[model samples]
Target: MNVCTTGCDISSIHLTCGWFSSARLINPRVFKRLRYNDCLVNNGNRLANGHTISFQYANTFRYPLSVSSVRC
Candidate 1:
């Protein structure tokens, strides 16, 4: 993890089951989400390179993810 030098973003990255979800940068506004079922997502697994790491994930099933976000 060595890809944090200021501004960076890893957003809207869609991944299915058995797939890999990775990010590299230094953006606090980086958003990640899930919409399907039986899928594992990691929002802080640095694979390429970056600063600041976290272990955020979710398991979606049945209905779609209900999120009230600012549509901009």
Candidate 2:
């Protein structure tokens, strides 16, 4: 996932998901979680200045999606 915080700058980011992955920059403490397809979630602390969150999912079998991002 990709997120643009309020005035905060994130030049670039990289993540790899064995089965699944989720990450975000919040409260100066970036949170990341990985798990299987059955279920996944990234419930980290909210940014002190609030947060901009994004999400992504890759195909397990078919066309492989390397990455996904969203701007908030």
Number of the predicted model whose lDDT against the real structure is largest: 2
lDDT of 1 by residue, 2-70 (tens): 354545543222334333233443233343434432232234343333643344443353224332321
Residues forming the 10-long window of minimal summed lDDT in candidate 1: 63-72
* Candidate 2 per-residue C-alpha lDDT over 19-62 given as tens digits, one digit per residue, 9 for 90 to 100: 54324233222434333322222333332224454444344454
Q: Model 2, 61: alpha-carbon shift in Å?
A: 13
lDDT, residue 34, candidate 2: 38
TM agreement with the true structure for every prediction: 0.21, 0.21
Query: What's the alpha carbon RMSD for model 1?
Result: 11.6
Q: List the residue pairs that clash in candidate 1.
A: 3-50
Which residue runs of candidate 2 sit more than 4 Å off their true CA positions? Answer: 1-7, 19-51, 56-72
Pairs in steric clash, model 2: 27-47
